[model samples]
Target: MKKWLIYTFAIAILAVLALQLFMFSTIQQQKNSDEKYFNMAKQEYKIFVPYIPDSLELFGENVPVDHVLVRERLENEIVRNMYWHSHTILLLKRSARYFPVIEPILSENGIPDDFKYLAMAESELTNAVSPVGASGVWQFMKSTAQEYGLEVRTDVDERYHLEKSTNAACRYLKASKQQFGSWTLAAAAYNMGGGALKRDVDAQKTNDYYSLLLNQETARYVYRIVALKLICEQPFQYGFFIRNKDLYQPIPVKKVSVSSSISSLVDFAAEYNLSFLELKNVNPWLRSDKLVVNTGKTYEINIPLSFSHTKLTENIADPYTIFKDSIVVE
Candidate 1:
């Protein structure tokens, strides 16, 4: 019995020692892992604050970046867009495809070319719908779109029509400019309605957009546009390093005019050697699967031109360089 007790005590001591050794080993391994992780983090990780340009302008109006509040507001947008890699990268790619379409329309309307960035600010150059029922790249509400000559019907919403919406936006901006007497104020009025903006101006006794205390969204509106303008104009300087080939190329398309209704877009697409998805992609303005044309109305459906992958690749080039001559910089 004494031998048994002695043996059991010896076994218990061995078990405790084993457990202690195992725990020590585990603690040592964790310490080494932590040390390695700290070393790697110290060597490799970095976050950078972007440089702010001394001078900035939007639509020929000098942004009051000299003012501390103005500078900080602009910096906030720049930093947000700069660090937001996915969103900004997509913006760059999409701008390559859509800017070519928007620039000409703005020019023809005698609107400042800088307003293209306003469209970017509005919808990221996409046919986006807002929560309050504003739709399109310009984010025009139904009444506003119709007022500006867009057809916002049950079957057809031209707000999604890129060219037409851009034209409508141009008209609106021009009218806003006339009402406000400055492009900056016009941009502000575009975000908050003209009536609301005018009320704010009168209440504050200030015609200056920067000076007038306004709603949060309206206050930040122009700054966002200016920030986008700066980054788009100098993407590389802002740390976006998109290659020419990486940029989205504008799809080649031909217009098919139809005075009559299209009974089935699927059939219509097949007639043009396209899939329904492809047809819809090119013509998002076509709301319904079918079209109804009144006696005097006509619609133009865009049909993408067929090209081999090699041929398409051969046409890929830097949009900035290609459209540089066309872009009017003030």
Candidate 2:
């Protein structure tokens, strides 16, 4: 009986040791599997530093990227925009829709094509209103809008008028360029007001935007614009791979001139087989539900071509062919 009991005890000890060995082997296998996946994951996802071009320009002015500070600032902007995937991608899409409208106006006004990027920096190509009462895609203050010949009033605020506001921006930028003698300084002035920028230039005894010490926002403004220009011009380089059809195409519109008042915009929209929302979407400058037209004054309202009396058998071709030419592959 004693021998049998000792044998049973020995067997029990062996079983416990075998169980521990199996558990340890299983744990080691799990650890190896986890390590394998971890290494694979590390290989799959990568974060890369944005590439910096050795040479860059804005508005025909050579950016002094050779300077350490300037290069650093430019890098800061590139990193910010590149990592900010959502906002940057949306800007890319919206630029396709809006740049076509803005480009011709800039050309007519003798503004450089690069200035459109400034507008993108300002409002992301949306009819945005700043907290300080600055409104529109150009982000014009009421006084500035008025000074630039934009009609800002209760019934009609032309600050939200894309074409008119773009014209106004051209006038302002031109005047600033004349005063500051550099597009870079003019862009700085656009952000930090002409008066303030003038004071900084005078106090520093330098008109070079790169040399002058500016407030934080104004300091980053031009760099941000240039960064946007670079990324947008070569989105593929910055890792933005967007399909052409995914871009927002410009909507075709037919202008309707109304010399008389529109008592009920909803009723007027219905007359043209459009929703009130559609009418307002196209004519955001129309402030109220009704439009008040003064004597001898006419408002040219844009109606989507599809909604207008014109017959359309198919969808319009892409109006943003510039993207095809501008995209850079590296």
RMSD per candidate (Å) reads 11.6, 10.9
The CA-based lDDT of model 1 is what? 0.85
Task: Estimate, for each residue in 1-330, the C-alpha lDDT of model 2 and write its tens digit.
Answer: 999999999999999999999999988767753355445435645568888878888999999898999999999999999989899999998997899999999999999999999999999999898989889999999999999999988889999999999999999999999999998888998999999999999999999988888899999999999999999998767867554545776767899999999899999999988999998888999999898999989999998756432233134343222244443212
Clashes of each: 0, 0
Model 2 residue 135 CA deviation (Å) reads 0.4
Candidate 2 — number of clashing residue pairs? 0
Error of 2 at 75 (Å): 0.7
Q: List lDDT for all candidates, in order.
A: 0.85, 0.86
The TM-score measured for candidate 2 stands at 0.81
Scored by TM-score, the top model is 1
